[model samples]
Target: MTHPLVKRYNLAPHPEGGFYRQVFRSENETSSYIHGETRPALTHIYFLLLKGKVSRFHRVLHDEVWNHYEGAPLQLFQLHQQQLWERRIGGQGNEYAEVVNAGNYQAAQSMGEYSLVGCTVAPGFDFADFSFIEEPAMKQWLDIAHPDLAKFI
Candidate 1:
């Protein structure tokens, strides 16, 4: 069954898995050296990850901040500086917000029924600036580095 939050937000399936609805896009634009293009100063979206679904590992050119809104805690994972890091957002003993640096590979999943979170990106977000990790290369790296994290791929 579809989660009520999904219906409330009218979210659409996201390419990375789960569902999302963009909530904000700043009208102000800025020239980003990181992206080499002018883009909205900020962008925000409501992201929902249902039980048993994962947000596949992906990277963006700008930093992303996630704010947990409701539902189960979200287990967010990041591959940064060749190290694997895990954080639980929302619920007991978990933080409400997390920041992922630019260029880090990130993924997440709900710890229970579902998780509703908001992601804010600086310099906005564009499909051109997003990319999923090549599975084979990521797998090879995981085999030598953090094999346990391979499930995220």
Candidate 2:
């Protein structure tokens, strides 16, 4: 069955997996203090994950803040600075909002039936600044940094 969020937002298939719709993109532009890439000041989007679907490991040049809206919780995994970390978002034990820093490889999956969440990116989100990590690379990194999370990737 189609998730309500997908219908409500008219979400489309995301390359990483799941579904998403770009909801807001600021017209303001600025050079990234970290990456030095020029982009919008802020960008917002609705992201939805259904059971059995995952947002594959990927990285964005800007910091992203995720806000929980409704439905199931999500587990967000990040690989950064040679370390692996996982954070829960939108569940009883999780924070309603969480941040994934710039340059960190991040991914997420629903913990139950479905999850509807929003993501805001500082310095905006651009396809040129997005990158998906290859499976072998992710496996090797996970094996060393977070062996327990290897199965998810």
Q: Specify the highest-lDDT model's number.
A: 1
Task: Residues 51-145, candidate 1: write the lDDT tens digits.
Answer: 98999889989999999999999999998656888999999988899999998999999999999999999999888899988768666887788
Alpha-carbon runs more than 4 Å astray in model 2: 135-138, 143-152
Pairs of residues clashing in candidate 1: none
lDDT of 1: 0.90
TM-score of each: 0.93, 0.88
Error of 2 at 53 (Å): 0.4
What is candidate 2's lDDT per residue for 1-153, written digit by digit as tens?
Answer: 787778879999988888999999999999988778788999999999899888888899889999999989988988876677788888787799989989899988889998899999999999988987766765787778677655556
Report the number of the highest-TM-score candidate. 1
Give the Cα-based TM-score of candidate 1 against the true structure.
0.93
